[model samples]
Structure formats: C-alpha cells, structure tokens
Target: MLSSNIFSGPIATDAPPASIGSRKDHPVPRLGIAAAAPIQTNKFYANFFLGNQTAPTYLHPYSVFWAGAKDTSGSWGMAISHIDANQRVYGSETNPVTGTPRYYINPVGISSICISAKELGSTTAVTSDALTAFSARIILRASLQGASVIEFPLVQGSAFVTAVFNGACPLIQTGIFYKTVTRSTKEARPGITKYKLYLEDGTTWLLYAHHTKGDPLDLQIINNGLAQAKGPFYGVIQVAKDPGNADSMYDRTCGVYATDVELSGSAHGEKGTYTFNFKKAGMNLTTTLAMFALPHHQTSFDDQTRDKMTDVKLQTTTKGIAIAVVADSWTMVEPSLPVSIGFVPWLPEAGSISNISSTNKTFIHNIAQQEMKQDILAQTDQPSMYFAGKALAKFAVLIMAIHDILGDNNLAQAGLERLKQAFARFAENKQQYPLVYESAWGGVVSTASYANGNASSDFGNTYYNDHHFHYGYFIYCAAVIGHLDPSWIAANKAYVNMFVRDIANPSPQDKFFPVSRSFDWYHGHSWAHGLIETGDGKDQESSSEDSMHAYAIKMWGNVSGDKKMEARGNLMLAIQARSFPMYYLYTKTNNVQPPNFIGNKVAGILFENKIDHLTYFGPQPEEIEGIHMLPLLPHTPYIRARDFVEEEWNTYFANGRAENIVGGWRGIVYANRATFDPKGAYAFFSTPGFDPSWLDGGASLTWYLCYSAGM
Candidate 1:
C-alpha cells in the first residue's frame, strides 16, 4: 500500500530546515557567555571559550590558553605551548626506552611565550569572539580603562600565535623565563621587527612585529624575562617556535599571520577535492604563507602543494608530527570516492548493486520477513533518542532490503507503514524525550538531559555531545523512507533537514545552525566531544560510525536531490577514508602512530593528549575494536580497508575467537570481517538458529546478509 515514486524532484537548495515545534527555550543550565549569533557547540577551540576557559585548546603543533595571569605579576595574557616529540612521557603500562609500550601521553606543556599588552594587568578581562570552525579570536580588555588592549587570533593549524595590539604597547613574556633575548636588526623587510627569544631549556622562538603606523620597534627586555614594546602600537605581533634553521623559513612567513581558515570542498564523479585557504592578515603579502599541515593532510596534499612542504617538523600530542608547509592554500584530493554507494550493497567500480545469488536472496528475505514482524513500537519508543533512533534505523534498513533486495513489495510496504508510524513519534516531537531547539548553544537537543539536569543523560545530548552520532541514524532512516515512498519527503523534509543542519550545516548563510558543527575541515575528521572540557582536548571514538554518518548524509542528499550536499558528503567520506586509517584505524604497516602503540591495531579511544587502547564502556578486545565497526553501512568497505580488517582479525578475532565473544560485539567483529571475507560472513549470518541478540540495536540481519552475499 506504500507504493510511490522513489526519485522525486529536487527540493529548494536554499530552503532551510524547519526548527519545528521543538524551538522552545530549554531550562537547562549552561555555562559561559552566550553569543548573540549562533554558538558553535562542537569545535576544536570550544574548550578555550567554554567551561573554565583556562583549559588549553590543542591546535596540533601549538596550543594556547588563558592563564588569568594570577601568578606572573598581574600580567594578563594567553599562554602558548609547543612540546617536542622527545618530551612525550610514556604510560605506566608500556616503556619506549627498553620495550614496546601500551600508551603515550603528552601533558600540557609549560608556556614558552605569553603575548600580553603593557596596559593589561590582573584585572584585564578575556573573552572570545568571531568563533568559526577553524579559528577563535581572543579579546583582552581592561574593564577599568574601558578600552580593549589586544586580540589574539588562534587558528587550528596555524604555526604562529598572533597578537594584534589595538592602541596598546605589546608585552611579550615567558612563564618558563627567558634565558636570553636577541633582537634581530637584519632589515629583512620594511616595517618588520624580529626578536629571537631563548629559554632556559635551550628552546628558541622568533617574534615578528609588523608596524602599520611606521612606529620604531623599541621593545625592551624588562626584568623577569618580560619584554615590552613602546606606546600606542596598532599592528601585528606573531611568534613561532624556531625549527632549527629558522632564519630562512621563519622570515618567509613571519610577517603574514593566518588569522582564520576558509574551507571549500567539491566532488565530481568519483574524484573529490577539499581545500583549506588560510585567511592571511598583516602587512606582508608578497611572501608565501607559512602554516603547519598535519601528517594526514601532508600525505593527501596534491603534488603542487606537497612540494611547498618544508623539512621543519613539530610534534603533536596524538597525531604525530606536523610538517611546516609554505603555502597559502592546501588542497587534498581523493581520486576514488565511493560515489555510487547507496541504500543497497553497491560496487564502486561497476557503479551498481552487486550480483546476489538466488539462494542468498531467499535466505535474506526469510530473515527480513521474520525480523519485520517484531514489535516496532516497543523497540523504537524508548526515552533515549540515541537508542530509539538506532532501532528506527534498524527497521528502516530491513524494509529497504525487503523492497530493493528481496523484491517483495507487499512485505516492504507493510513494514514501511509500521516504520513510518514509529518515525512519526519522533517527527511530531511526541517521543518520551522530545528534542528542543536550545538557542543558547544553537542546536536541537534531547529534553531528557535538560529536564533531568544530568549531563550524561542520553549521552549528554543537551550539552551538544555526539550530535552527529545521535542524529545521523535518524537521518539515514528518513533517507530510506524518502527513497521508498517519495510522498513521505514532502511532509517530513523540514524535520529530517533539521537533523542535517544540526550536525552538518554546509554554510554560514544558514543562520539557524553553526556551519559544519561537528566536522573539523583542517583535521579531515569530525570530533564527537562537545561542551565538556577535558585536559586532552576533543576526541572521536567510532571512526566507522563517523564514516557512516557521512554516508547517511550522502544518501539523504541523493534522495533529496541536493547535489551540493551529496557532493559534500562524498568528499567528507573520501577524507574520512584517508584520515581514519592514519589516525584511528592502525594497520600493521601504519607508521603514523607509535610502533609500540600500533600493535593495538585500532587506536582505541583516540584523545588529543593520549591514545588509550580501550573504549569508554569496556577494555575487552572485542569492545575496543567493535565500537568502530557497528552499524556497518553500504560505503563501509570504502573507508575501512580490507588490509586493516584482515590484520585486525588475525590480531584479535582469528580462528573462531570471534564466536566465543558474547553479546553484540561478536556480531560487530564478524560484520567487519565481511569487508575482507564475504563468504565467511554470508555463512555466519545465513545459518539457521542464529541468535538475534548478537545484532546491535542499530543493526539488522537483512543488511548483514545482503551486504555479505552481494560482496
């Protein structure tokens, strides 16, 4: 009875997703100053402005934070820290000196340089403004003086921490205490002043001050390792760590400060390219821009951009060393994206669904029919949006398989009607824990956490945690519904689009939501941590789910006929395919992670400060590896390589070891193994008397069988 045209006309590209009835203001308490414009809840620099505001925000090679200047003689400034690879302290479980290690950590380093203003004191107030995906501008003002002194631009991947003095003399100080201060008088360029600062630990840094008003650079080194510049300075002051041969490379990019980053990406057919253009600010433009590229970025950089890479390298806490590149813009290309992947099992090369055997098709159909007869309302009516959404998505996949793969239109229709009703409970905001569009942080969130005053309720939904992972399943469900019954899209377009905008709003032009709220363009992946402040910084646990979220976006875009969104989704998937292996999914040959650490196969719970070989729930080998393998969708094989899967299987789940594992984890490991051994997976799922409990709430037997058999 649910028969309808699947491919519908494209919706209006500019039409924003409706906020729906959940636009009511939430009563939950939120910390930090509220922004008049939409606030970015999930971003790299959010730790700086949110919570205590003193926690360091990691920007790869360099990190900066507000110190409050309580200890340093009332000198209010942002503390800058850059730790070397040799400075990493190994975990107690493993030792790098004598034997292989289990973990490594790089604690927050001592500030080498603190850029302040001569006018700033203990009473200076600090606030962040102009926050974007890749940048945050820190403003320091003296409340009594009623004048702003300086603004520090903190970018995610920029090498230099820039200070723009606004009518205040620049005061450069070091917490570690400077051993020597050598002022560079080499007439490198007009209106440019350079200073070489030496620390007690033999660490050297270069400070380049560009004067727009032609003021003479008379920065005097005062007592206690403090340096002060002369009056009414209105120009840029940038500082960078001396990478050994600093005089030549530092001079090329000292004057030009990368204040922000502009991200643009495009996907054409199977090829995808995403570009990061460093928004340069300062007096100099003739010279090239000097910015640090992460290891993943460097590996994917085009030949033209890759050639500009310098030998200078800086160690990051978790992502290995970042290489310094002399270029204004860097574009990474992925020539083979799984653009053809869809709701069904698809082969990228053939650009179509894989041929499934007749026996396997009947086997999948019997399982799907049996699973579809279960009580949908009982499973999907849970209070938690995460679990409820997962159930809804599970059933949606089953219905799709019945129709598309099984060619059983009548059964698919019956199951789809039940699914639509279950989804209606969510779309109408009638679920037990409905969503509310909280304007304070700007996104739709579950009322469960807001009402209960529990931060961990529904996995911190009210606090903007895991928005991508929570809402992505619902989006995928809606996409499948739209694909099956095109008539459904008209009524639910606004509701489903709201979820998309919440997680992956593509443009700032949309005022309702933050642009790319979860995805970090500079890092080539999305971070799950939000609002909650941690010493380690933002982290993402499930690389597979991260890629699945992107695949959902691609499918939703495809069904909705939003070419740009579809293309962006394809591009994001490509980036994740490249980035996940380097940072999260560790193959035996992966040199990106530490040699001792890579033995863990998968980078369990990758944090900015440390990589623990475990998950939040449990430390079991299955749990550690299974978190990234669940809810395996169509394009999973594209991101998760066969080599890594095989290596991981041999490491943990080889020789029937997976069979012994209890609960849903066993299914996850086997589902992941399907990427390499489809025959084995097909046999496992197709076997009679299979335990239904093995499947996760988000997974279905129909999908597992179709995926394996088609492959």
Candidate 2:
C-alpha cells in the first residue's frame, strides 16, 4: 500500500490564471440568458452530463472543434454549468455558419472555469458505481496545457456545488471527497513500492497509491506530479495515459486521491515540523467524491494470514530529503533431500574412461566449481524444504565428484556435513519443519512448508500434485549419501523409503495415500495438480519434474536393491518417452497417441481436457521449450527421440541462444543439448559473457559430464 498526505484550502479568489493563449478564432457575440434556434450542420456537440437530483448539472456542453491544435496559441478552456432539468429556453450550444448563437448560456448555473493554450481532443467518458459500475474519460490533449493552472468554486445561491480547476496541466489532477479521523504515510523500501492511506471513521477507507517500474505510466505521473488536496476533504483525480496502449487515450489512466488531507510531523520548509489538518464536509463539486461514494468490492483472500507484513517509518534527513523506510517480511522456504545411490556411477573417478573433450569438461567443471562456492557460502540455516532442497542436493553431488577428481577431502567432507545436517533436521523434526511421516499412509508427506504460513498450509493445497517432483530430490540425495557412507543409508533407508512409497506405491491398499496419485497410468506421465480445481481441468506445469520423479525412483531402487521399484521407474520412463512427444511435445499439427490434446506446438502445460501453449510464469519461448529439456540432464538415456531433441533445439534455441537463455535455464538447456550437440553445448556454456549465476543449483556437473562423455 502507498499514500501521500495533502492539506490545503479551496482555490483563493486571487489565484493565478492557468495559462495564456493567443486568440485563434473571432470572438462570438455573447448570447442572452433566454434564446432558442434550430439545429445546425457541420457542427459536433455532445451532452456530457444532465441530471437534477440535489441540484441541476451540465458539464462541457460547448463544442471547440480546433481545440486539439498544437500551435503556439489556440482556443483552450473548459466551462462547467448547472441548469434546471426543465429549463427549455436555453437551446444546445450550436451556432450557424453566420456566427449567430442559437441557444442561451445559463450564467446563473455556471460553477467552475479553466483556460489553457493547448487544445483538448479525443474525449472519453465512463460512469459507474464503485462495486458495480465506473465511468471515466481519458482526454487526450496537446502537452502544452501542462503549463496552465487555475481553479475556482461553482456556487449556486447559498451552496457550493463543486470546486472546478484547470486540471489540464502537465499532470492532470481532480478532486475527491473522503472523511476520516486519522491519516498517515507509508515508507518506501527496496524492491517494494508501497504507500498507505487509511481512514479511521468507523469503517476504514484506504486509498493506496503505488508507482513502480513494472507500471511506467504511473511512475511518470508520480515523478511529474501527484495530487494535492485542500482542507480535510479527500480529492480524487486521474493522471497520465495508460501505458499499455499510449496511442489510444481511451484506455486506462492512473487515478490519484487523498483522504482526510493533513500534514503531520513536518512543516513545508523546516526539517521537521507540524502542519494543519482540516475537517469539513459540505463541498460536493469534486470528481474524487463522485467516484468513491459508490459501493466498493474486492475478492476474498484464500488465506487471511498470507497477507503482507510491512513496516513504515518517515524521517527527514540532514539534507532535507524526506525518506520513508519500508519493508515486506514475507519470504519463501526451501526444500530438502538426501543423496541417493544410483548417482554413484555418474560420479567421475580419477582417470576414469572419458570420451568428453577436455575443453567441454573444463567448462562444465568451472560451472560446478562456481555453483559449489555459492552454496558453500550461502546461509543454509534456513532452507525452503522443497525447492531449495533440490539445489542443495545437486551441490552435494557435484562437490563429491569434484573431490574424487581433485582428491580434495575437505570439499567432500563439507558436502557430507551439509547433507547430514539437512537429513537430521527432517529426522528429528527440528524447527517444526513440515515434513511428516504418516504411518497410516505408509509414506512421508510435506505439508504447506513452502507456503510459509497461509490458509492452504497443508498437503491438500498441492493435493496429489508434484509429490514425485518434491520427493525425487530427497530420494536422489539419500542415494548419494548411501554411496559415500554405506552405514548412513542403513540408518536412513526406512525414512528414505517412505518418500519412495508416497510417489511410486503400486497398489492402493494403503488407503491413506493414493496409488500413484500424481502419475496417470492412462497418460503415462504425472499431472502437477491433484487437489486444486481449475475449471479447465487438472494439468502438469513442469514435465521435466515429472520425469525426474521416475528417475529418482529408479535411482533409489538401485541403491536400496529393490528390483521392482527400479523396473517400475524404467517402465515409467519408457511410457513417458513415447507419450510425451505425441501429447506434450509436438512436431506436427496432428498426432493421436495422447488423443484429444495434440497440437502443432508443445503444450506448456498439458491438461486432461485441454492444452495451453503457455507457461504459467510468462509467455517467453524458453519457459515453454526449456522446461521439456530440463529432465534430460539426469535422464538422458531415457529420451529415445534424437529427432525430437533436434526439432526443439532448431525451433527456439538455435537462433536466439544469447538473448533467450536466462538464469537457471541456461544450464538446463545446454546440459540437455550436450547429449546431442556436445560441441554446441560446450560453446554456449563457455561463452565469454556467460554468467555463472545462470547455472541452476539443481543442475549437477556430474550429470552433465556423464552425459557429455556418453555423447
């Protein structure tokens, strides 16, 4: 939330005029209060507003055709008037070619006036209540009007209908009405642009103003000029054209308002002082009051506790730069996993039979070394039990292999120690980590550990989704630890087996846990959602994670000497290779293997009933194509189609390698390509400006090296 306080009075009688413009057209004779005439041609006039509730109202009824001119001086002005609904003597503001007025102008109801050098063109209008309806206009005019500034009150007998101003300045400002007992400003902080405007009159009325790089137009308005209010009344105004389509002024525009206008803690000139706070309510001539008075509505949060935790502090520095310190306290938790057994053979020993070029091997080794250094230096005291666990496990595997190749006992010991600590945390249930062993289900379950603390803080949130994806890293880590220290596997095998059972249990006899809940026996690949209902149906976001689950099971089976588990893993891989290309990855417009979901392009997320060729995070080509190749690194041999890999590479990766490849994704793309085009993969990884930060901690040097050697 973001807010700014403003405390000023209504426009003074002697205030300066907005701007001056040279006369462009001949001045017409003033019309009397009562006059009428027939309609005229070659003229355009619109009825902006006409109603009679508390008072008669009419705004911008006159037509100024050439008002959009960009010349030095032109006709630039706005007039607002109110007439009784039954007033028939005054005709429309249309004149004949002879320059004779056809209707009378109601001088008695005229409320506010503004003038400028710029012409106003392309006027749009919207009218709606807060919750059900909203009406506004995006007026596009020459930028020159920004210099003009003037404001005045529209009084009808004893009452002031509204205060109108020459809001046609560099930044457009309007008026709003709000009443509250208390008001304050929220501070600013890195990566977060937030301000708070809270109204404390029984029901809380908050108006949050935010400006950030993601929204450029709003940023421009904030930089140029925000809103300024008078007295205690809140004023609503619109500023800046919509950034989405600048060419079309009729689109969205930035809205700014002040509630319970007041200045506290500091004076205008002094370093730290106090100012006045106003409390009055009879003026109704502002746009702000009209907009917010309607009913307000918002979507309910799934978890109320998941709201942001923010801190705000306002202070003026010695240099008089008023700074507000603010911060958000919500953070994500990382996942954990133990080393597994099947990864041992992939670990390169000293002087092992190697087919990879020294150059490619050196590039892979450098990436591994850099990633290990980052992990070693990182504070693992607080880990996000699921995602981060995969990264940590990859680090352990890479370091163990690096130790074998370089004979660095210290590096291997450090990796082992980290794994031990991570394993102990899960086993002993330290820090109330959410990993639970459900004896009834005969498996281990991860609650909403990744969710921090929210309403969906349970396994049910993810439902049957990603169990294999989440548990695969843990299974792989346990196998690695078993390879290094056989006794450790014996002590932890029971705990490790629980995760394996959760993902790969063949039968449904357990009752508590579903039989292969995520993996679809019919589709041959796992779905990412089992609990949440998307109207379109259940879908899997990451196919790579789906394959990794099966690979982890196979690896775990190898180390634990469970032939049935190992065979199941192999079967799952074979099924995925055949079904994935036909359904998930498409080379042709029509393929029937997956049935009813075939398409010309790969489905970013494949659902039971539909295929959306869009990634959940964004629409980047890498997000769509890169995900399919990620699982290929550890499960390279399982991908039987070299042609499919070639097609994917040629489609998205070949031309824009440097432009498209981004953080974490670079490793996945290049490592997967290593199996087919080892030289190209090495070249990309060794590119001069290649960033080490681009390497995903989940990518293993040993896996890359192993795949490169075979290629």
Candidate 3:
C-alpha cells in the first residue's frame, strides 16, 4: 500500500470501514473569528471555501484544499474548496482555544454530503466502539445580510457532526475563469447583476445574481463603482443556509455579493480595465451560471500573438455584457503552453540510381584520386592554420568518403588525425570556439566572448536559426570519424551527443536543452531561428542544410544504435521531400504554392507564417543552385524527385552558370547535376586545364566519382 505521506496535505491516517454511516448529535467544536482584519499579506492561502452544490460540507481527512489568493492588503479573500478541513479556512473566523464559535458559511445554491467519522480516516478494521461515534458537525450562523436567526434541530442520541455547504469553486475547476467588464450601454434588470470573473489559470466564470437587483448595488452601478474605485476590485462570495428549507439549500436565488467593494476601482488608470461585449445583448442567469459550473463546458486558449482572440469562444443565451474590470496586464493570461511533437523516423526503403557508364566512372575516379592526394598532403601541424569546426567538418566528410571508397588506409588515417586535432582544440579551449556548446541554453552559442573583451561576430545569436546548418556539418563529421575509428567514438561519444540532443531530441525534459526548438511539428520540418524573434518570424534559408541536418542525425543514430534518432532523421527527410518541393523547390506547372508567386526559383528562406522566395544574403546564382546540391552529399537512400533535379539543372546550371560557379559550389553543383547528366558532368570535369582551385573544400571528388559510377 502507498504510504499516506506519499500524498501531501490532508491524508486519512487510516482507512475507513465499509459499514460506516452518518451519525447525529456529535459535539461540535466551537469556532470564533481569530482575526478578521483585512488580509495584509499577499501570501498564498491553501484553502478558501467557495460554496458549490456538489461540494462536501464536512471536512475530510484526506481532502486536498483548493489554493487561495489574498491581495497585498488582505482585506478580501477568495478560495475554492472541494471539501472542508478545519485547517485555516479563509474569510471566516475561528478560535483555536474553543475550536470554533459563531456561524459556519455553506455553499448556498448546491447539494452537500454528510459523512461518518469512520469514513474520515480508518485504515484498519473498525471496532464496534469506533463505529458508534460520529466524526463531524454542522452549525448555522446568523445572516450578515439582516436575515432572521437560522437554526438546525439538535439530535439527542448521537455525537455532533459538521455540515458542509456546496457551490462552484472556479479555482478547483480545470478550465479558465476570468472576469471582464465592458462599458457599452446595455439593458440592466432592476434586481439582477452579472459578473464575468477569470481565474489565474485563465478559465472564465460567468455569474448572475438577482439579490441586489433593485438596490443601488445593481450590476450596472457596481460596474461603474468598480470602474471608479480606489484599488483593483477584489471580492469574496458568501453562501448561507436558506431560511425556507431546513433540510436543503436554496436554488439559484441565493445572494452573491462582493465582500470588499471599497477596493473596486482605486488606481484605475494604473490598472487597465478588462472589458468584454457579450455575443448577445442581455444575460440569462440560469444558463450562464450552469454553464460556468459545468465541467464539460470549460475550455482553454493558447497565448499566441498571431491569433490570441481566436483561442477561445464564449457563447451565451443572451448577449453578454460589455463591461471592463481594472487589473494589471500581467494578470490577464498565462504563458504559452509547451509545444506538442510527433516525430517518427523514416528509413529510406527504396529507390534506384540512374546508371553511369564505366568509361565516365573511370574518368571521374582519376580526377577524385588526384584531388584526394593533394588534400591529404596539405594538412598542417599548426592549430591556428586549421579551419573552424564548421569548415573542418566539411573536409572530414569528403576525406572520409574518399578513404572508404578507395580502400586507402593512408587517407583514412590522415582524416583521423585531422579529426583528433579538431577534437583536441575543442576540448582544450571550448570557451574560445565560435560554436561553443551552451548547457544553460541547451544549444550551441554561435559566437563566443573573447579574452580581449571583444565578442565573436556571432555572439548572442538566436536559437536554431543557423544551428542545423552549423551543427549538421559537425555531427556529420563526427559520425564519419566514428565509422572510421570506433575507438575515437568511444572516447568522444559524450561530446558528440551534445550536437545530437540539440538538433533532434524533442522532449523538454532534457536538462541541457529545450525540446526540439528548431523543428516545427506543425510544418513537418525544422525552423532555423528558435527563440529569436525576427519582425517577420523564423525562417530557414538553406533547404539543403535542413536536409543535411536530418541526414546527419539519421547516420549518427544508426551508428549509435539510437533507432529513434534514425527514425527522426528519416521522418525529417520524408517530410522535407514532400514539403520542400511544395514550398522551396519550384517546378513548372506548379499551382498550389505559397502566396506572392516569384518565378520557379527556389524560395531561399521560408518563415513560419510567411514565405519569401528570396535568399537571405541576396539572389546570388550560387545561393540558388547550392540549395538543391547540399542534400545529395550524404545521399542517404531517401528519394529526391528526379524531375526537380532536372528542372534545377535546366533552369540554373544548364545555362552556362556552371562555368562561372566558383570554389566548392562548382563541384557541388556539377556533381549533383551528374546524377541526371553524367556525360555532360564528366566531360566538364575531364576537360584539360581545369582548375583544381575550383573545387570547394567541402566538395568530394570521391562522391562525384561514386555518383558517376551509379553507386
């Protein structure tokens, strides 16, 4: 059995026997007002009684009380309780020495239960003597509203038992509760008053009372009084016994009045009024109150700026009132709820490579072998001469692939040495690295603070903006290093895991990072900027880098035996394969696309809510061409539309753009295009006097050769 202490607050000391029944004439503990001074502290009170019909009148040993709030002055108190426990009941007076005296407030308009003492807390078998005694009591207090003395019949034989009042407690309910007052002129019934109150949780409660209908305290005047009052309005609702019924409570006709009307509108200008115009013009008391009390009728809203108003819907029998209540802006709503994600990795199951002739493959191989020799001999011992992690990751990717395809242990060892040096630098001077991993933010800091009091160029960068693009290269390099040297992986897995957690893990439970901040579950792809708020919102400029991120995750997950990561990678690829074509990559005869049609050129950056078909840096030809080339590097078995590749080649590369393509981009574009037109791609690379300087450090001649061979 679970220990009672496992459940905090009030818990039954023992289990009650099954045969327990209600007893009468129990000696009631006298309770008197200990101190009714205006509540001066803004501290939280555990229990405040709000009368709900279904609420229990008597205290239960195991009952958990609803949380209560007191303003700074403590003049007023509001609490919701499902059950009464004699511990510190707010808004009521209690004398500890005599137990209790005076009257008890019960929920006026609802039903309550009378339970036996044994039922309160009995874990063992109940003795006959234990069953004979009653456990609780109830007493009536005189009406504070000038009503006649109220009394209950005294039982002669049994011990006294406490009676509980019942009514709705907005705090105990699951949905939002808020009060709104509007200023527009609306009809006011003489004795009826309407109130729309909100709970801190953002659940709204609509109340209508007929008691003060004809008085100066009617709903309209009350609104005006609150609008003009001294401090923000705070209230306490009281429920008393019905004079007409001895055995039951009154219906909806009971009085519901504000306890402290003095604090209604004070400092009105400082605290703005929350106003609302009901859907209809008048109020329907029964339906409105009933709906507020009904559990099924409750709803919640997300606090998003784009569609804040549409998050909730309020329907009323009569048009709701147009009134406003004074409150601080911070008290209006809650922060946005955590995002929900559904990530399923999809491993590429099928697709065939277009065949390349042996003559072309041999020609491509000769070019790749020569480039590999030069790259291997170019490594330097000096650390400062080495490229940054992002650039180094690219070189590692190419060299590792070259070594694997050609069975060259010399090249593999050379690549391993470079990786080792890179790892050593990161380990020794992690703080100096541009892409420093930040445990506090659960992502890498793109820029670092230098010892010379200068911040790196990318310091204080936003989340996930270029994370995938930057981290993908590193993660891909790590995966390749792990594959080439298992010992290196065993030594560096922890360091490598940081990148994995940043890019793929979707659970906020991770202590080091936020849940998949970059990936958008709604869009079925990742966004680059996570927390950074651009005026236009987050966007992803490099669709290729997006795919590269997934590819790296998939490969690393496979090597690391994390099926979930592999699956996420596949799922990302699958989604991008479909979403990118629809949004980023344009083909002829495209009908369904983002608004503001640009030509068939790929959209360089896609934002969350908007689409800009332009690149971030500008409309450079390489920027447009490279977006389609990056995903082909890893060449995981995922499908890329051949038609799209053909279209890109015809639209951009086929028209002499390849001749002007500089550095690594030339090889990337030509190699990727080789997938479709091997003869043309091979002929271009094989031409005499071709400059090896044209090859990007990230580009792999081995990959070019492999593609030419249809591998």
Q: Could you tell which candidate, 1 or 3, scores higher by lDDT?
A: 1
Cα miss at 700, model 1 (Å)? 1.2
lDDT of 3: 0.37
Weakest 10 consecutive residues, lDDT, candidate 3?
124-133
Which lDDT values do the candidates have, in the order given? 0.79, 0.39, 0.37
Q: Write the per-residue lDDT of candidate 1 for residues 1-711, one digit (tens) a residue.
A: 101211122233333334344454544334333255467877777776666667788887888877777434345787888988777877777422224466677867467888887677767766777787778777777753456677877887787888887678777888778888988767446678788898887899988888777585677878756888767787888888986875678777777777777776666667777778888878867677888888788888899999999998888888887888999999888887777788887644544574677888877778887888899988998988889989988998888888988899999999999999999988888899878876666778888876778888898887788888989999999999999999899888888888888888876767777778888888878888887888788888888778878888889988887777777778789888888888999887888887767877777787777877768888688887898887888887788888888998988889878899998887788888888898998888877799988887778988889888877
Candidate 3 regions with alpha-carbon error over 4 angstroms: 1-365, 374-390, 427-440, 446-464, 530-532, 594-598, 636-640
Lowest summed-lDDT stretch of 10 residues in model 1? 1-10
Candidate RMSDs in order: 4.2, 28.2, 23.5
Give the CA lDDT, 0 to 100, for residue 96 in model 1. 25
Model 3, range 339-423, lDDT digits (tens) per residue?
A: 0111111112223333345665456546655654544323321222113444555556556545654445775586678666755
- Top candidate on TM-score is 1
User: Each model's TM-score, in the order given?
Assistant: 0.93, 0.47, 0.49
Off by over 4 Å in 1: 1-19, 22-35, 70-75, 94-102, 230-232, 347-354
- 2 or 3, greater by TM-score: 3
